[model samples]
Target: MQEKLTINYTNDLHSYFENWPKIAGYLKGNKQKLQDAGETCWLVDIGDHVDRSRPIAEAFRGKANISLLNEAGYDFATIGNNEGITLDYDDLYHLYDEAEFRVAVANLHTKTGKDPSWMEPSWVVETTGGVKVGMIGLTAPFPDFYNLIGWDVQDPMEILKQEIGPLRSSCDVVVLLSHLGIYADRDIAAAFPEIDVIIGGHTHHLLHEGEYVNQCLITTAGKQGFYMGEVEIIWDTEQECITGKHARAIPVADLEDDADTAEQVAVYSENAAKAMHRPAVVLPDPMPCGPYEDSRAMDLLTDYLRRWTKADLAFLNAGVLLDSFPAGAVSYMDIHRICPHPINPATVPLTGESLEQIVNAALQPDFVSFPLKGFGFRGKVIGKMIYSGLTFDITGTEAKPVAKNLKIHGRPLDPKKLYTTAMADTFTFGSLLPNIKQAEGKKYFMPEMLRDLLLEAFQEIEK
Candidate 1:
């Protein structure tokens, strides 16, 4: 006798609800047909299902995402960076409180290194024919963010080393739910031969027919529910071993959606909208956020950030604010709609010479108008650089402006003197701001995003 084990999964949804109904329908429909045909079906989510950029995810703090997963009949789920570090400690700890599915995270724990009751290191499923399959879930680690939010995330590789041997010995087939990106999955496949299948996410690469590396099958269905991943294992029940492995990504854009699921999502969205409608502040005047032009809102935001972080100077792009708040009672929904990036504030110490270089570079049209991606920016472009406690003259041509007569706190900048600077944490990563990226003594403020700061700043108008 033989058994067909179906592992269906989704990853990096990131609160893209427009495509979720179809995905949910596909997963549920396939599960019913497979199980009705006497096959074993296991549904899983590879994480990042909860993104604050969406009103439903933000308003309920992820409980709604759990309800959707439960409705879709997910058997297991893992954490991505969005699920792991974006939320506060308590929120992330209790995120899956009502999740009917098992939340498997092998490398994350509390600050005291205690495992949450909802977290499982691995999952073991026994098929009807008695073939056992094991799953080990691992998420990408951002130790600094996790630490700031009162959780400790260990290295995924080290945790894998500890858990793989045990999981391998206990089950006929082994699966890895990796939220560590495509390149990391390839490396894991080559490093861990015992891993029979690796279903991945994070970098959001799609493998239509799956990629085989070192006798291990690696598969992923990009991001935002564009495709659904399927991995099948042919289990020989008589021998109690897995004889074959196959994987494929199914496109679901034009697929039929479950009416009930769609209705439920609409209901959730409606409720979230109502919840987010709570008043943030009453604005006596309109505060426009013009990315390419000077905006009082951006200026005030920079000033608030500098004061909040207690830095000598601060600066951030005008584009951080996506829209304007008209004169009236602005709701939390309005704030989130306008400034939805899950970005944090940070302070970096730099010498005046380095600061001058960064200012000049930032003034460049390419840098200011860059359609930046990653590092947690959820906006269209960088826009104009708005400064607080600093001013300078641009003397060169409009095409290539050169910053001169730079002053910090009403005095000329000293080349050898170091100053504490406040900025969005996104600048600390990559080469967009090389001097800031290379600067020392960088401190990040977590849990609260830039939107939170804007909310507080908007209240000042009421006063």
Candidate 2:
């Protein structure tokens, strides 16, 4: 007999729960309709559902996001970079503990456990008509961060090579829940033609109708909760094969919000607010912060970064601290509000020439004011470069300021001498700082974000 299995999926929500009510409403209502028609329907999430920038995700450590998934009736899911690298080992280990869905991530492995009980290498879903679909999940490989946090993130291609053949033999349809971005999805599609469908995220590319490559179908809903993805598989149960595949992203902005889900989200916000209300410190004096102007908070925070990493010199982007703190009891919530980026403190070993080059690049006005996105940055712009254990002289006035007379370790920069430069890992990716980005064997401090350091600074100041 012929059968149809409908897969409704979401990706890169990033804790943007505003449109979640409508998303949930669409899924819940559509799921009911498909079931009534004697077709199989399953709700799925592609990950990045729990972004720490959100109060609810931060307060509940992503348990709230999982709860929302449970309420939405999600059946299968995967992990994204945000879901995998943003949380500490303990948090990620327990993040899916209460999830109602099956978590299939083929490339994630933990050193702490023989296996993560909540994670499966692959999941086989059987439809009402007994059409078996094999699902494999993979996330972006960030070995440095993952290694620091005691996770052995395997290469996606290698894991797929090991898993696909076995999984394909056992199921009628093979699907991939991939958080490795669209480019990788295309590559994987070319490499693995047996994969009938690849649901992708991470780079946040929008796909209205879906992309067909190497006889494989690729789909994504982009970032936030703006759109939801749907896939229909026409299966021949008796022949045990897939006949057709179709996918599309449905916009949910104009849809009616599910009142119950909206109410629940509001409740989660209230509870998260209450949970984060506890005071971190009572400020004796207001600490100022901003992107363009000088910030004592940034200076102090840069000093703390050097201290935390024990690096010879340290620097940070002022924009990371979003707001100023008033002279009063500051709560953990306040800290998160002021600095919400999930960035890690990282150190890179570079020669004095490289350091000077990075510093010169960072000193450029256009460079500092660049509206950076991604790579763990959650701020408006790159902001002023704040430094610690380093000083420099300007060659000109505000007309066109030139950074010169750079000095560190109380001496002029040496071209050949290696220096450990401490900074946010945000600068280590893409083309932000070529010297830092190109540097090898860079050390990333995991789990501890810039906000955590800011919190620690305030707590210590209270002493």
Candidate 3:
């Protein structure tokens, strides 16, 4: 007789809770169908289920996400960058303390030469027909980010090599819950032929019908809980060796909502709304416009960054502040609404020539005014580039910079001198400016997001 196993998975949820009920509803219905037929089934998540971008996640530091996942019946899971490096040590330490599902991450260990008490490298589950299956989870190894947050992430390759060898002989099929993006997924498939399936996430690439690498079939459901993945394994019960595999991504948009799960979500949503309404600040009068120009709020934030980082200069995009200051009653909730991204303050060193190019590039008519999204930028538009510790004389109409002669700390720009400037990391990778891309010795400050800095800046303004 042939025994078939079904695995349903989601990846990169990032706290888009509005769609959670819908996805959970579908999973519940599917689980019942599989159970009634006496077939074996499992539900899993590849990682990134928690993100501070949402109020519920930000309030409880991902504890809410863990609870929600547990309520929805996640059987197994892994960690992604959002879950790995974004939270402080204590928060992460206790984040999964209450989780009911098995958390498998072979590559992660504690910084003090001990593993997290709740973490396991691998697990073996026996099927209804007594066939054993092995599973391992992996998170991305971004050491710099992890280090800042007081955690250490090991190399996935090294961990996989050590973990998979034992599973090869102990299990009929091996599955990998991978959060290392597509390149790493391909590499794992090539290097480890023993792994029968690779479920992936972290680049948000959608694989509708799955892809095969060597003997492994890989699948991903993309990001935002919009899709779910399925892996079907047909095993011969008697032989326990001969089998076939299939994987696919399933859309959940049209799926009916389960009433019970929907009720749970509504309760959580109401609680979150009430908690996020805490006060931030009280503005007696509205602050003037221009977050990038000479406006009060932008200038204040840029100056704060300069002083805080001790950089030679500081720059920021105006649109970082989303809404205008109303006449009165500015609260933490209001500030959060205006600046919701989980962006941190970063400083990069650049040469004087590179600085000129950066300034000039930022002043370009189309460049400064562009509406850019992604890369941790949740603002409306680029607006303008606000700078501190620098001065420039402009001569063009429409505020376009022309014949620019710039100075730093009352001195003219030196073509050969290196100056450390603080700026948002969003501009460091893209072609926003040559200087930003070519910056050297970049230092990123974590745990203290840009919004946190903004609140500090506002406090200073109030003082």
Best by lDDT: 1
What's the lDDT for all of these models?
0.90, 0.89, 0.83
What's the lDDT for candidate 3?
0.83
Worst ten-residue run, lDDT, model 3? 287-296
The alpha-carbon deviation from the true structure for residue 101 of candidate 1, after best TM-score superposition, in angstroms, is 0.8
Q: Which runs in model 1 stand beyond 4 Å of their true positions?
A: 236-243
TM-score of 3: 0.93
Model 2 C-alpha lDDT versus the unseen true structure: 0.89
lDDT at 67, model 2: 93
* TM-scores, all models, native as reference: 0.96, 0.97, 0.93
Per-residue alpha-carbon lDDT of candidate 2 for residues 1-463, written as tens digits (9 for 90 to 100): 7898899999999999999999999999999999999889999898899899989999988999999999988999998888888888889989999988899998989986676789998978788988788999999999999988889999999998898999999987899999999999999999998899999999999999899997899999888989999999898767767788899999998999989999999999999999998898888889888898777788778999999899989999899988899998999999999899889999999998888787777778788789998988889999999899888887766645777877886888777988888999988899988888888879988889999998887777777
Q: List the residue pairs that clash in candidate 2.
A: none
Which candidate leads in TM-score? 2
Q: What lDDT tens digits, residue by residue, belong to model 3 across residues 35-141?
A: 78988888998998988777778777899899888988888999887777678788887778899999998887778776667788898998777778899999989
Positional deviation of residue 337's Cα in model 2 after best superposition, in angstroms: 0.6
Query: At residue 231, what lDDT does model 3 achieve?
Result: 91
Candidates ranked by lDDT: 1, 2, 3
